[model samples]
Target: MDLNYYDTLIAVADDCPVNGAVVPALRGGKKTVAVVQFDMISADPGGLTQEDVLFETWLRRRESDGLSESERAELRAQFFSRSQACLRASPLPKKYGWGLRFDAAGRVTLCPMGSDEYEEIIAGEVPGVNVLKAMRSKRA
Candidate 1:
C-alpha cells in the first residue's frame, strides 16, 4: 500500500524477519514506549499529536543542549510536515506490541494489539477513531 504522509494501518509481520527480533527499546527507534508513557502520564488522555509528543520530549530533555529556538522549531516541523514519511514508520506498532489510534482531531494514542481496547477500535466500535497497524518489517 502507498503510505501517505499521515497514512494509518500499514500492516507488518508480528516478528521482523530482517532482524529476527523485536526491540522493546530499539536505539533510535521512534521511542514508542516513551510516546505512550507520555500520554498516559499527561493530564489529558488524547491531547497531543505524534509530533507534539516528540517535540515535548526533545524540549524537556535536550532543549538546553545546543539547538537554538529556530532550529528547534524547524525540527519540530520536520516531525509533522515537509520532511516526508508518516507515523506508519513509527516503531510503536512496527516493533513494539502496540497499535496506533488516531482520534477525530488527529491526535493519537497507543492501543496494544489484541487488547480489549485495540480490538474494540479495530472492530469499528469507536467513534471518530482511526485504527492502523504499523509498517511491516518486510515488503508485502
Candidate 2:
C-alpha cells in the first residue's frame, strides 16, 4: 500500500478510522466527512498516476474552507491520533476505487472518474458544474 496515497486519502476524507467519523469538534462546530475510494479498471498492480495525485490534491484543497479554530484543532488531533488506525482501516486497493462524499446527512455519493471527465478536470473542468462545457472545450 502506498503510505503517501493513504495519507492523501485520509487528508481528503477527513474521517477517523477509529471513530468512523470526523474528529469531534474541539470547540464544538460542524465538520464535513468525505470518503475517497479509488477504482482501477485494470487488475494489474501499479501505483497511482500523476493525474490521480493532482486530482486528490485538488479535492483536498477544495474541502479546506470555513473551518473554525476549534474545528481545525480537532482535525489536527484526529490526524495525529488516528493516523495508524486509519491506515489499517482503509487500505487503498490495487485497482479502481470510488470516492464517497458524506455531507451533514451522512449520505454517501459515488464520484466516478471517467477518463474524459478526469481529463477535463485536469484541464480545469469543474465537475457537476461545467463538465459539459469542459468536454466541449477539449474538442475546440
Q: What is the TM-score of each candidate against the true structure?
A: 0.57, 0.21
Give one digit per residue, the lDDT tens place, for model 1 in 1-140.
21232324323335533332233542465544445443442445556665665556556555346778898788767655545345566555566555655554656555556667766666787665545556676677
Give the Cα error of residue 78 in candidate 1, in Å: 6.0
Local distance difference test, per candidate? 0.53, 0.31
Candidate number of the best TM-score: 1
lDDT against true structure, model 2: 0.31
**Cα deviation of 26, candidate 1, in Å:** 6.4
Best model number under lDDT: 1
Q: Give candidate 1 misplaced runs (Cα > 4 Å).
A: 1-23, 26-45, 54-71, 77-81
Model 1 scores worst on lDDT over the 10 consecutive residues at: 1-10
Model 2 residue pairs with clashes: 37-97, 37-98, 38-96, 38-97, 39-96, 39-97, 40-95, 40-96
